[model samples]
Target: MGLVRNRVGLPAKCDLQIKAKREVCSFEFHSVPGDKSISQRAIVLNAIAEGQGTVYNVLRSRDIESCITILRQLGVRIAWNGDELSVHGQGLRGLQAPAGRLEVGNTATSARLMLSVLAGQSFAAELGGNALLSARPMDWVVQPLTDMGAVIEYLGAKGCLPLRIQGASPLSPIDMEATVFSAQEKSALLFAGLYAEGITRYRQRCQSRDHTERLMHYFGIDIHSDNDVTFLKGGNAFCAKDVMVPGDMSSAAFLLAAYAIRGVDRKGSLLIKQVGVNPTRSGFIRLLAEMGLHLTLQAEAELISGEPVADIYCTPGTRLSSVLAEGNGRIQSLIDEVPLLAAVSAFAEGNTVIRDCGELRDKDTNRIQTTAGVLKAFGVETSCSDDEMVIHGGRPLSPAIVNSCGDHRIAMTAAVLASSLDEPSIIRNCGCINVSYPGFVEDLSQFAHIDVLPAE
Candidate 1:
């Protein structure tokens, strides 16, 4: 494989060098990063619980850091000693008014979930983020919280951040009907419902990630799910306890994809330890298996904090074929991995269609367009519409410079794709990978020859 460089000559935090068709002759065991979703939820719930709580194996990334920073601004006492995070819960109504606006950085998870928590407080505060976050819509949470009698005003463009919220001491119970299958929206409402006067019922056509529900149950909160609906009664007390966050499945998806695309050639097997395989978030594994990837679940599968945990083993499959990924109710489970999946589709035998995923456009960047752009740069035939992406597979990828668009998933996906190609490809804005998987370059380096250098 030959090396390629970016033509823009822009300075970057990290540049990756991936040798194509690299073979790994030895078995590999990797301990991926802790689950960011669970870590964020644990931090928020622990801060509002009734006593002191400890979270182990929490991810140390920019996204998690944003959550910690906002919690501290709201009077939650949080301390980090290496891998252990300790939080002193002040109870549901115990949060003090922030002295200044809460800066959420570029994390939509922090912005949306924290917005709901702020709605039940008794003081007024402002929520803000970076330029990228400021462009993503916040109306999904704002509209529902407003219906429950929480006063929120958009400080910037309508339906987006920065938001000025005047909280209600006793929020009104809401019968919310979800218009989209979004985990962030559902979790936000459930979080705010803790302060309502009666039961807050959320009904959706499809299920999203249930981390909030599971963590609530783990912390002794009263929450239940019926068909198409999750209801939480207000005034339930949360008891503080220690939580051990499992390894992030989303981060593991990149590794799994790398092995799926190249393991047959490398003649090696990969084992990822202590990964959270929550059914609602395991769509990547399920979908990849359907597309002819061989994966095994170790016998140690168990439950952690009401979530499923297991070790994932990946090996090369006999053949690769295309599969359909529609944006039905199940899209929430695999939303973060769609970009990586699209990249892998380049190695399949037939056309892969990803439809009904217009929601990808609303992320940190236009993921559907960005995913297609990356594949196209590598000489793959791809096309994208408002709600669908089609990748014509069976074509060998060529070396070319690809842009990460300042998005972490895209950066990691590009790196994975580059590793499988026959020539070297440059990934611009590679440092954005730190937002979710700061250790991605380091972890992937174990299996392949990679070099990290300054962009220019």
Candidate 2:
């Protein structure tokens, strides 16, 4: 077997064993786990709401656990009974200060967005994270927050983690534009706007996720989007509302690629139920359709907690053709799913070009280069650049020895590619998958046999 080494200095955890048949049997179920993005938002928004809030289908993952843990430390009452989540609101100005530094684990989403909320509280608090989270840049979210009167003191590196923040009540609301296409940055601004007295306006570099915007509106916050611009009216107390989080689109994308590529020559279709179909997060769906995947979404989509929910049905075996997946316009939506696309595209009849992927550098690893390395390890020829990757497809694949490098998506993507062959693929450091989709191995088991081996 060919080897692709782990380069990010990740300690050995466990090996993921997945060997999928060349063809998959059709299956359908009611659940696919909750959306991580929506789950984190629901936990925070409802925690600071005016009354008690009930959240249905919140994903129990490491990333989301960070949000819940921090909220509890801030004196918010949250209870989850395995099915439903209940959060007692602290109102708009009620969160108590933690005893010391609030240590948020490896979740960057939890750290950045939570900092924005912390900026509106009435205490000076310090936020810290694990080594991985500490290395990421927080400037995009911090700068906007500072402009709104939040005093930020970096205890470590500038714009990185482990910092103290002092929030301003009646923070000055301002119209601002983002230099990066980031949903988190937009959400950081809007969430802090609740403490401001006037309207806070935000502009994006490109269209990104809008779960924050939609959830704000759901909880009776005055927020609206005109074209790509969003505005939030401040000083409004939130009314506790029930939120039903849809299944994660990011997780669903992995399932879709695995079954779709293998299903092409099989009978029957796989039905993925009640997954998010937000247009802002549907770039991969559009791209796959353009690549000739046989897919159908329910015509009558349901709206849950301000997000579109639909049952997506797919039958594999359609010949895939490569289409340009450019970054500027579609990167925000596809950033989390590009690895899956690039890996599955190895079966496509032509060369697949993914351009302007520089944003991937800021992920847990340099995913752009890491993805190229994984593909090459599987005997797929690839041309990689700083901002672009071209995968030469339509060739036979060999068994591969790959590493996740602590990236969940990269591991899952490589496993999906391995499932296409008769031999199993060994993925090191798969514990990282718990950060996002804890149920992924079970879900993928529908198409293959998975073995969780002890780390040496």
- Residue 229, model 2, lDDT: 90
Which ten-residue region of model 2 has the weakest summed lDDT? 1-10
Model 1 is weakest, by summed lDDT over 10 consecutive residues, at 1-10
Winning candidate number (lDDT): 1
Q: Model 1 clash pairs?
A: none
**Which portions of model 1 miss their true places by more than 4 Å?**
1-12
| Top TM-score prediction, candidate number | 1
**334 in model 2: Cα distance from truth in Å?**
1.8
Q: Write the per-residue lDDT of candidate 1 for residues 1-456, one digit (tens) a residue.
A: 111111122233877878654555543544668899999999999899999999998888888989999999888999999779999999998999999999999899988888888899889999999898999999989998998888999888999999899988788999988877777888899998998988999997687888889999888888899998998998766788899998899988987887777747565666777889998999989988899987888946656588778888767767888999886655677989988889889989999998878888999899999999999998999999988899999887888788788888988888998887666778877877878887777566655667776774
Cα-based RMSD of candidate 1: 4.0
Give candidate 1's whole-model lDDT: 0.84
